[model samples]
Target: MPDVEDLFVEFETAAATTFRPPGVADVQRRIRGRRRRRGLLAGLLAVALAGPASALAVAHRADRPEPRPTPSVSPSPTGRLAVRTVTLPGVSGELAELRFVSARAGWALFDTCAGADESAAGCRRTVARTVDGGVTWQRSALPAVPDGRVHLLPVDAGTLAVMTRVGYLVTMDGGNSFASHPFDAPQAAVRRVFATPSGLYLGCPPDGVPTTCDRQRVLRVSGGLHFHQPPVTLRSDAENALVEGADGRLWLTVGDDDGLTVVTSADQGATWQEMPSVPRAARQLVLAPDGRDVWLVRTEQPNGVWRLAGTGWQPGPALPDDTDGIAAPGAGLLVVTSAYGGLGFVTGGGYVEVSELRGPLRTSDPGTSVSVLPDGTVVAQHGRTWFLGVGRGVDRSWLQLS
Candidate 1:
């Protein structure tokens, strides 16, 4: 018989010669396409060794689809939340994202199996709207979203901005009577949409590979989804992380997947100004409850967390080294990781922790995550199950998410 070691050596040589891992740019492009899968192995690996908050920044590169996973609704004696089930009409997958502009209005995005069953390659997408909070949802008419991935933005009580392959869809009278406008020929592919107090903007990354469409630009739309003159300076196909400030100005964070930059645009995307305070190599960006900049820097080990205060950056707050996300979850507060895979809200003085978790907390689990909705509701996940913020242990009450 042939030597076993020699046969293994020969097979290893064949595999290495035939296979190669992708470079940073390729990974960035794929991240954009598969953002809805909850957590791709590569994305989780990026979070593991990439620094404290790289996961938060890179995770925003794209987005999710799935049916609503019903969790056990045992009454929480610690808080006022009564776990509940949310059903989406014709939902064939899991809920990718959900947000409520107020206690009354909200939206959800879903990612489903491409062909009746889930696929490793990609997925199908859908959107649902709710006027009486998240308890029930109905399909919202949208342009046939090829990948079912979309960015949903609430402009006001009666307005919303949606970006999909069918172009930019907007509803002025709530979810009823949505209007779609085709993007200018070169800017048709929808990358992202942001609804700011000043106006809403859509990111249009150039099509083609890095060799061809290597530039990325954003379109400013108002009154309707019409393109304004002049585009933003970001020139990569990777989706940029964006946030709006109370001043009606916008802050954008873009990266090469290996590093990130934060820039500001006061006159919309027509002009931009780079904020040098942010670390050039840092990948994570968080807009604090006070509208200040918070960051996780680049280090061999992610042990430091900083927030910008006045002239210099200072240690922002203390969180477990395993902290995966941060958000302003109402009450002049921030939702942080609590002990035993639970959560806490950081207010003016100290941390308000959520203790005695009865089940697996997805936000603390691998690949799963938590984020604060526009209204400061903290939503966490372990798998398909979701937990919404109700009342706090101190000075809070169970929410009426009816």
Candidate 2:
């Protein structure tokens, strides 16, 4: 009988070669088929170990099997960004989180579950790296299995970090290996992780429960993964939205007893200057691909959207009622994700809908998301397919990626 490690190596190779997202029905069939093969392998291994050489020899005859599984900045010719699909080698399943440190290098976190059944026990947490844009990918092993959604923070081309309810995972040599770090000091669940030139910051709540994190407490780490509370003070009792500028400056919105206010910190989080308060509370902050513009999105009823101008915010036209999240493809335009399904591009004082792209980013499909690359290209994920949004206005189209 072959070694246990060798058996798994063979199984993985066969699994990768057999799984591909050709269509909805095809993916389901492949998943079911792979599960059966895995079950057979497990049963055979059990029987072989249960007895002696005789059982091993008999189990060898049953061999068979298979299976497996960013935004940019520039405005295109038509006033919006154009997208061209770049097939990723060795990648399948919907992207749970996609982040890029540069135009050429990035990382993605996804699972092996078929369709929208992410709660399935078979959904294995998988991570992949892409160096040549999103053209190809290299799979990496995780330090520990994630409990829920893992936040992807790319420090550079090779260094990156991921955080979940458990703690932090850091990889200096890309994703080759990851080292675990505990979330002890803060003693709260890390909902958001941000990377800046100064270091890494984690947004943690007072307690582990509650859907929204109040208190405006941020833990900053410089050289090591040790998270300590910074000297900076925030006034918000609600949730705060944070974003880093091109010049390493930090901008965030705070909602306190006085209402909602915008603030910026140039010297890390030591100090901040509060701007004029806005009418609505913004839940998310997005910086443009070029990093020259910032937009605040309020997911509440009216779907309020605002662009930073001087010290105040300039309100854009109201987004659709079903708006879930927003991303900036360029300096002035926006890509809005709908709760029903699909995306919308805000341009020419109005918006154009991309009906072909299904799976509403953060709402109906919680796994789906949209991001702009540093080069101004908009990338979005639908069910099991990834897409790059290219062209502008009517020319805008989605190119499917692996």
Best by TM-score: 1
List clash counts for every candidate, in order: 15, 18
Q: Would you list the C-alpha lDDT of every candidate in the order shown? A: 0.42, 0.47
lDDT of 1 by residue, 338-399 (tens): 22355555545545555433344534543334455444445554444555554332334333
Question: Candidate 1, TM-score vs. the true structure?
Answer: 0.58
- Cα lDDT tens digits, model 2, 1-402, are 224333333222221111111121222234345555763222110000000000000000011132110122223333333243433356655566565544557777775553443245545566778887677788886755654434555555676656544546767687899877654432211212232334433333433211133333553433233243333354232223344555566665443333345677767666777665556555445666445666666655545777878777888765766654466766477776555555767764666666455323334433344555545555565554556665543355455554
Give the TM-score (vs. native) of candidate 2.
0.58
Predicted structure 1: clash tally: 15
